[model samples]
Target: MTVQPYVPEPLPPAGIDWEAHIPRIASANRALARYDGILQAIPNPRLLLSPLLTQEAVLSSRIEGTQASLEDVLRFEANPKEPIGDAALADIREIINYREALNTAVEALKTRRLDLALVCDLHRVLLSGSRGMDREPGCVRTIQNFIGRDAQIEHAIYIPPAPEDLSGALGDWEAYLQGGELDVLVQLSVLKAQFELIHPFCDGNGRIGRMLVPLILYDKGLIGSPMFYISAYLERNRPVYYERLLAVSRDGDWNGWIAFFLHAIEEQAGANGRKATAILDLYDEMKQTVPEVTRSQYAVAALDALFKTPIFSSAEFFEQAAIPRRAAERILQQLREHGIIAVLAEGGGRRAATYAFPRLLAITEGDRL
Candidate 1:
């Protein structure tokens, strides 16, 4: 009985094989377009649902190994310090970081064009104060790093660029950006996938890769808003996502990977649409009911705040809803009575508990978009 020695294959020079991945790309884009249609059909204020939806998408990636349910995430929002069953305060903080990063990336996209510099900024937000720093945000790796879970190490699956390769690869990337030859959406999707394959940072590759999709879309003007998200679809189909990524690298399975990606776009777009429609409806219902329940201007203001962020605290509600502290507190009670938002456990010593729009919360946490 003899053991065979392991042999490493030559690495494919960094690039995508679009010709081979065309069918997959077509199918995936079809899926994405279908959902985009759904999103476009929905009405306003409801469009605000995109952020909450994006938050769920980000959390899905962050808590990848935890197996924590959606309820756990929403619960963490109110009681981040005491989320149920194994998720720690640190996890809650990570979730909040993810939300902030998504917001940062999306807002930047909406406001202006994206640059490699912005990529660095997004990584800065993502890995902020984490152990992974000490290196600059987009600083390419000088050596290989292993990705894996716990002692097993198999999950360790990213490779940042060698420090020397960083500038050249980014140079090529910027050149492509300026060439303006590729379709913008196609360019964004391909560029993101390529970025992941390049894996230029020692940490934050996944989040940064995901962030790039929307950023590029915004940069290209395909979307004025950051409504599209891939984290949920990728996290949900983790095995397939990884397989496609690797397949494109080893087997020239770009078509398959692109199709899968486009499918993610399609499916996620539809899910976002449904959530958006539901969110808008929820807003109208709340507005109609609020006046009857409480005639205060605070009610109107709280409704406005919900569009910015669907959850709130007495302090936040008081600050944004523009009512006396006591009046703001009472309005929340009325809101609860009207089933607008349900209270969650309090933390951070705010005296008043935090609350979430549980139905909206449910849609955010639900399976399938």
Candidate 2:
């Protein structure tokens, strides 16, 4: 028997037992508030939290089967000319595009609301020059699509809305996004699930859906910026994440999914808070260490550049640190001697050497050296 495409109902689905979820809603809100406070306290969060963004991109793409790691992406970025095989290169490019797309969306949200147009633009950047570029980037699907084991629709585990009904369903989704809801977080949960079920684009739907999490929170004023990283939690609980989403369409279990999502927000917010705090602390420590190790007046500048790009080439560092070339070289030598920065590859002839800030990278990876 063939399964019909899942036609999602309009947003603000009725009959949700909101009262039963009061405790979870409160806890999630408190956790998010604490995280946001930390975000505001950090100086130049964009530079300090940069690694977390890359990790978010890596994990989000990994959920869609991308095989690149945070280190792989950074190393390849530091030296794109290195031959890392076609498959790995392709995966790294996708991961890079994820970060680029997310950054684009964050900037676009400053002047515009989170709507379909912005979302489509994000989709365009996400699949540009990657494997999914040929899947009609930045456009809604014109054909039926389904989630299943293989390409066969008969085996489809979850079929999204048919092509003809997509516009109406999406219009409702966008309107609901603009309208106010009692609980912004719950609204986010519904919006995310609804978009996935709608499956607007032929490719990059899952990624775009996940990208909207931080964007929505920022737009709703839940966070200072669109830097919250929830993918770490979602990726760890991959099976349950999908199960909760499927349960909504399979058994009309919105409450179940909402509960799961709220818990995700609560738990991930705490984890994100801890990571941000650690990164900030490391930044403070490096402030004194870089000066002590290199004994250079440009210590603060050098430290900031390293935090911005944990894995970078000698040339990149020279340019980013923006100090005299002689001072940069001496500082690099001192840093290497003191084990502050590990040389990933030695400089050869005219080729620049690559280096890694293991201590900072370790914090982002949830490990400490």
Candidate 3:
């Protein structure tokens, strides 16, 4: 049987209880205000930490899909110890893939408006090979499905509007963004909620919803880049995440969900900002001591990718870093020379030696999940 898409019913006649979410709205505003202060106060002094936070955000978001216990996922992410189960492993890989999509989306945002095309591309990247979306890359789901408490699949929950609705909705979102009537952080929450309510695609609705948040922010000139990830925050607050989403559907509680969503953003943004700051400090300290004279300028980028995937081998390094084989080798050595990283050889030429960013790897292995 084909895996059809899930969609909520059309906007109900009673209208959403937009006002009921006032408390969340207030809290969200406070968080966003705090986050904005940090964003303005910390930069250049913290620019380099962007890659690390970006990697963590993307990976943490993917972990949310694993259905793993939130505590377990956070434990694994904070300091992965003992091999994770196969399902969790799969989710981690998916998260890593999302990070790639995020990188692409962020770069694209810099050059183009955050239109449906960019959103479609993000869906394509996120749902590239999953059973969701029937592997159409960016196709929307025409059918409707639902998830019961036991993970039971139910059809006929709600039918999604035709693909044309997506274009219309996205246009409205873009207009609101351009008008500056809505605050950037609050707008991101509302836009993400609206996108999910629209449920444009037949598959990967959640992932796409999450991706839309940062894309909107980046496009609106809110964030310097797409380094913040709400998945971790949402996953931590999964119960409220689902409840508020449903509230929007049941009572049109837009204000509530928007508030919660913005709060998620504010919280994640600060966490990301701090994480980025720490990583940047580490990178700068390493740079000052490393003899830059011998390494390519690209080495810094390679190091960035290290935090992105702190436990990979050289082959994996070159792929994400997008550097040539020989240059990658030279750069790896440079990292080792600065004591920023070390080799993990299996000895006796029996296997390929692996490289690890010792401190960053340690953090992933023991902290910052």
lDDT of each: 0.62, 0.92, 0.59
Q: What TM-score, over all chains together, does every model reach?
A: 0.79, 0.98, 0.69
Give me the displacement of residue 125 in model 1, in angstroms. 1.3
Q: Give candidate 2 regions above 4 Å deviation.
A: 367-369
Candidate number achieving the greatest lDDT relative to the actual structure: 2
Error of 3 at 305 (Å): 6.5
Tens-place lDDT per residue, model 1, 287-357, is: 78777787886676767766555565556666766778888777788878878777775635545577777
Best by TM-score: 2
Alpha-carbon lDDT of model 2: 0.92
Off by over 4 Å in 3: 1-64, 67-93, 133-135, 149-179, 292-309, 314-350, 362-369
TM-score between candidate 1 and the true structure:
0.79
Residue 168 error, candidate 2, Å: 0.6
In angstroms, how far off is 122's CA in candidate 1?
1.0
Model 3 root-mean-square deviation:
6.6
